[model samples]
Target: MSPNPAPRPSASDTPPRRRSVQCAGPHGLHRMSYLEWGDADNPDVLVCVHGLTRNGRDFDELARAMAPHYRVVCPDVVGRGLSSWLPVKTDYQLPTYVADMITLIARLDVDSVHWVGTSMGGLIGMLIASIPDNPIRRLVLNDVGPVVTAASLARIGQYVGMAPVFPHFEAAEAYIRAVSAPFGHLSDAQWRQLTESSVKAVDGGWAMRYDPGIGEPFRQTPLLEDVSLWPIYDAIGCPTLLVRGAESDLLTRETADEMGRRGPRARLVEVPGVGHAPTLMDAGQIAPVRDFLLAAGAAGGGR
Candidate 1:
């Protein structure tokens, strides 16, 4: 399915604010940069984690929309966006991400948090929230589940794990759009924002925000024919919401259906024109999220 052209934002538009926190990493210390919106003192903390190659900025629109209700924290996973790169590329696995999140949560000093994750981020959230004494009160898994498709995994492995340098931002944007077309319809302006957010100015050209070596571990992981994460999903005790792009290749329809039927009985919301993931950047996307968060909060009553 072809992506719809993303709406254009005016020149006067202001991007989201960013802040950094030093977190303990395998290599001693690392700075994790994140985009923060809403009241810092608001105890209602909502942590939004982005996809593999994507950054925290992906949640800019969603954060702004959710700020009125909760303090939205969107972190740039290590080795991605403005976050510090990992010294050991092998440390780019889920355990490292969970550890970083734990440090971030400790810094927040919040008793519990509401989580929203896309793709790889969703997997991280699932792993963490499934722990025996996890602090996540509610979770929203965006286009990701325990059972991932090999075809989608292969497609992601083809590009995400690689480092691509472009002579100009336009070229980089075009490349991202081409590869991410599976993400459904997005406006030209949205595509532009995505391209701008993902690339950094190098000596003469632009390079991806993450370390090129990340692909090393990603490539080495073997693909499973039939992935089942039932135990992990079953262990989650909090209210859960699952959002999937209707045309997503990564989160198969069958997996999404099974997710709803299984542990926690995740409520599923399918975005009509998206695939692989939903970027919660528009009203249509944000509504379900806001509704879910409110419902989760009401149901749990301050867990």
Candidate 2:
């Protein structure tokens, strides 16, 4: 008998398309680079936003998987990734992010969009989508909620403000892996991608993509036991999905439950063996998002 042929990869396994768009920022016009996959003309637009320290590249695998039907746009929020960092770190707040996103939406010339956000990105979506004339038709909040935990905030603050210099990419990657253990079980390739997108070669060493001063506002801010934004979430009118890593220190089980019970009554999913956030790279992780977006698109007239 002839040897069995090798299995062919499915379309969903293919790589994503990439592109960059310039968006107006506080200081002149800056290029807000994005990874665009699927047909440019597709009315079904899904915008994926990354976490505080992460860039748009975090959604590469997820975007590739969803490209068959949706135009997946993953933007490097200002001050992160290939996007230009703000000269004034104080401007690195949600209002600025929301404004930049508005500019991006206008540039796309779309009526509305489906939003998927992780951690800090989730907060931006929650704030923007809650507006009276918001353009987000459906929302996905990954590992974040209206009430942020002090413990998680403290943990993030510990590192967010620190500027680290690494002798090489290996060292930088190792450091990232150590701190990002809460993300859980990423493959060697995935880890490498994260490292590459997060660090840049500077002189003889490697450093993070963001401005270290960006964290100054966080440090200068007052600490509180609980910071509530239930009003903002309640204002959201779109269908919403919430994903929480089972062991996440950030989005507590209580918060996730409350998120479902109140405020948009978001559909909730929990990923095992992960914490803080889900990267949406794995099939198991990406499936819920794909399903959610499809349903949202169908309901929102392909917004």
Candidate 3:
């Protein structure tokens, strides 16, 4: 399916707002950057978070599709994109991310929100939704679940801390496509958009925008090989949707099936011909999410 042009902004003359929130980290304080689309004052807010080594702009297509129905907010999780990097490598874990999200939600001043989280971001959403009195009105877990595969972790870690320099953006786009092929089919335009935000021109060359030291935590943690977050997943009480790429190596079919059988009894949707993750950048990818989120809105809230 072809991707839809982004909906005309509620006020077409204005563009998506770039906002920041001051958040505390183990080292001190940093500002997390976010792009807000749709009605800022609209009570209906949806937060879309990106995967490991990915920044928030990865959701541009997805957020654009949902903006008319929601105050779509996408955060460049600290240490990536325009957000500040953590000084302490160990601070790159989920706890800090969750805290930063809470700060962001508070800034939005909305009582509750819908969430679409991809990969590592999904884990963060699970943790947040598990908490008592949390505000995740509905949850969408994209290409990640309680259990992750060791092989997938190994594959990801291989390039997590990469610091390759490119003479031009096209060169960097090639590198990104090589590593991100696991994200499955994406148009040249989509991949190019991702590449534009993933790097920066520095010293007459380009380098990744995120802090390379973030990889230290990946190396330090033993959780990759033997991680368990079922207790957290099971505690989530909100309506949930779990989206998995049919060929995803990280979120196994077995795990995806089990997700449907238990804990939130999450509604499951699978996209064929994708692996590791599905970039909801096209109509085929974004339809289920739009339908799910709007259904939830119609049933109770998000107006």
Query: Highest lDDT, which number?
Result: 3
How would you encode candidate 1's per-residue C-alpha lDDT over 27-129 as one tens digit per residue?
A: 7889999887776666777899999889998998887777766677899999999899888888888888999999888888887788999999999999988
List where candidate 3 sits over 4 angstroms from the true fold: 1-14, 222-224, 296-303
Candidate No. with top TM-score: 3
Each prediction's TM-score against the native? Answer: 0.91, 0.90, 0.93
The candidates, ranked best first by TM-score, are: 3, 1, 2
Q: Which RMSD does model 2 reach against the true structure?
A: 6.2
> Which 10 consecutive residues of model 1 have the lowest summed lDDT?
1-10
Q: What does the lDDT come to for candidate 1?
A: 0.82
- Candidate 3, residue 174: the lDDT equals 92
Q: Compute the lDDT of residue 167 as modeled in candidate 1.
A: 89
Of candidates 3 and 2, the better by TM-score: 3
**Candidate 2 Cα errors over 4 Å, as ranges:** 1-29, 301-303
- Which stretches in model 1 have alpha-carbon errors above 4 Å? 1-17, 296-303
